[model samples]
Target chain A: MIEVKKLRKSFDGRTVLHDIDATFYTGKTNLIIGQSGSGKTVLVKSLVGLLRPDKGEILFDGRNLLTMTSQEVKELRKEIGMLFQGSALFDSETVLGNVMFPLTMFTSMSRAEMLDRAMFCIERVNLKGAENKYPSEISGGMQKRVAIARAIALNPKYLFCDEPNSGLDPKTSIVIDELLSDITHEYGITTVINTHDMNSVLGIGENIIFINKGHREWVGDMSQIYTTSNEALNDFVFATRLFQDVRAYVAKHGKI
Target chain B: MILTNSLANFGRYCMFLTRTFSIPDRWSVFGKRTIQEVSKLGIDSIPLVIIISLFIGAVCTIQMQLNVSSPLIPSYSVGLATREIILLEFSNSILCLILAGKVGSNIASEIGTMRVTEQIDALEIMGVNSANYLTLPKIVAFVFFMPVLSVLCMGTAFIGGWCVAAFTDIIPVSRYVYGLQTMFTEWYVWYGLIKSLVFAFLIASISSYCGYYVKGGALQVGKASTDAVVSSSIFILLFDVILTKLLLQ
Candidate 1:
């Protein structure tokens, strides 16, 4: 579990995250949802140590991230895995090589052992035959799966994905979402996803934090999301006609 | 304002070098990457080096022959001039200037594309020292391969000059070879090799730095590639002057 306390960040005096506090539980898919420019990306970047927050206590299972030395941070990062929005697979490496990279970097396993583990990850992600293919050889969905396979290759204690469903079709998005959810539950990893995809939010968001203009406006699960009383959250969740219809049906049926 | 910005960038670059020069987390990986970089940035560059040196050597011979067309000047002066030009300057400094366009821009564009695409971020999050992992191999490979390239360039240019002598009525090939052998200070070759090593490091590091800190999208990556080539060329020329003065004196 990761706990953030009073996280404040700004850019050139423009506050982006204003004294935010949140908790991500283990074995759950925690989603950070907000519109574009709502500071969700900044929050995720800060959490992953890509960006330093101005003031905050980022506690990864009680260890303070801000106070840790650079060496310690690097050591701690071994237990952390991230899937970038663009998948970010090394263009030069094949899917198998990509999956084997973290193991190759951090493990004492021999080549055959590493290959076996990488093959296991590839099989787990349902990308058995695509191992020899480059990232460019695969579709976006397959690339994301490859990214996921690589992310979980280490069986990390924490998993962070930045907009994991962006640029993917609806069907592919659901597959990626279910994969993330299943992996989170399977490994009991503290999985945090930064996304605005409604299907993802309603489908797999076990613990959701809705940020509005750099402020946390609402915090709840998908079940409570449809019946939330927050006006800003309502504006965001029902912005589309399909969601509005869902909201209406939820109101009439008293549940979704 | 410009001065302040430049100072800031210099500080940032120093910090970047600090990160890049750190001990690799895995030596085996580093070795593999260094070999890969050598092939990509060094061996692949051989044909271009050969072709350019050949043409430049021929041109140097022809130009020397045309200009030294006087009875007072010895017939061997054309060969001597071509040898001196190729050995003292063209093989090392001029060759690096040309490579700043091909290899420097390549390093810049590749790293810049990785930056814009979040590949570097991915490395960082995986606890890899992205700078060290990415840039060190390129720097080490280029620096080590540079002296070999200088020697090859010198030999190829000599062949080109010999070809000019053999084909055109500039000078006899025997005389040209004699002139190349005459007063050939082995130190001049060492001097060129040393200069090439420094220039190679500059090109690789500066280009990697430009690419590593790239912001925005594909356009910014292109701009970084241009900046890398331009900056590397400028530095190579500047260092050539400094090294020439220091080494020759």
Candidate 2:
């Protein structure tokens, strides 16, 4: 489990996140959701040590991530895997090679073992036959799969995905989301996903934290989200046409 | 405004330097980047350098034949002049220009694309020292490969001049070899090699830095590429002047 307390951040004197606190439970998809520039990305990045918080303690299973030494941080990183929004696969490497990168850097495994592990991860992501293909030769969805394959290749204890559905079609987005959820349940990894996709929030957000203008607006599950009468949450949920229709339907039936 | 910003920039750079240097494994990362940079900058640049060196030698010889009417200044001096100029300026300075146009642009574009796409961020998240992994190898490769390319450029230019002199009847074959042997200096060759090494470092580092710091998207990458090449070229020329004045004296 990951716990953050009073997390705060600023860029050039402009505060982006303020006194935010949340917990991400293991074996479930913990989502940080907000609109653009709402500090969701910054908060998640801080949690992952990508960005340093001006104030707060991020305890990963009780180890304070903020105060860890560089060596300790590297060790901590080995327990974590990240899937970037843009599917940050190394353009120069083939699918298999990209998947094998983290292993090569951090492991004593032989080349054959590395290849075998990479193949297993690739197949796990349903990218079985595309091992030799470079990232440029593949579609965006395929690239995201490759990124996922690489992220999981290390068998990390913590999985962090930043907008995994960005640039993907609705169908592909659902596939990606389901895959992440399934992986989280299967591996029992503490998974934190930063997303704005309402579909993702409703479909797989078992533990959700909503950020608005850099502050934690609400924290709840999908079941509690629609019932919450918070104005900001209502505004965000109803802003979408599909959710608006759903809200109206519930209202007409007096079920909301 | 300028002064405050400049000071702020300096502080930022110092912070970056401290952060990068604090890591013990950065040397290994540097070694990796050096190899990549060498392959991109040195190996890929062979064709252009060869083609340009040959033409430059030929042109110098032709110009010598046209301008010199004094029999006292031997026709073989054409080859000698080509050798001297190629070693002193053409190979070191001209090749820097070529690299600023070619390799510099490549470094900037690649790094800029990586930055925009968040590949660099991915590296950081993985606890990779992005600067050392990305920049060090290129610097090392430039330091090693630039000198080798300088020698190749000098040799090719001399051959090109020899070819022109022989074909145009400006200098006989035997006299061209004699002039080359007489004019050759270990110090001059070393001086040129040293210059090439400096040029390589400046070009690769500045270009890579530009790309690494790029923001936004495709347009930003393009702008970084342009800026890298322009800055590298200007710095190369400026360094060349300073090194020439110091080393030659």
Candidate No. with top lDDT: 1
Candidate 2 structure quality by residue, lDDT tens digits, A28-105: 999999889999889988998989999999999999999999889989998899999989999989999899988877
True contacts kept of each: 0.94, 0.75
* Model 2 accuracy (lDDT, Cα): 0.87
Q: How many residue pairs clash in model 2?
A: 4
Cα RMSD to the true fold for all candidates: 1.5, 2.5
Q: How much DockQ does model 1 earn?
A: 0.94
Model 1: lDDT of residue A215: 96
User: Which residue ranges in model 1 land beyond 4 Å of their true spot?
Assistant: A245-256
In CAPRI terms, model 1 is classed as: high
For model 2, the stretches where C-alpha displacement exceeds 4 angstroms are A253-256, B1-37
Residue pairs in clash, model 2: B33-B137, B33-B138, B34-B137, B34-B138
The sequence of per-residue lDDT tens digits that candidate 2 reaches over residues B108-219 is: 9999999998999988888777876776677668778988888889888888888876786766788777767775788999899999989988887778778888989999
Worst 10 residues of 1 chain A by lDDT: A242-251
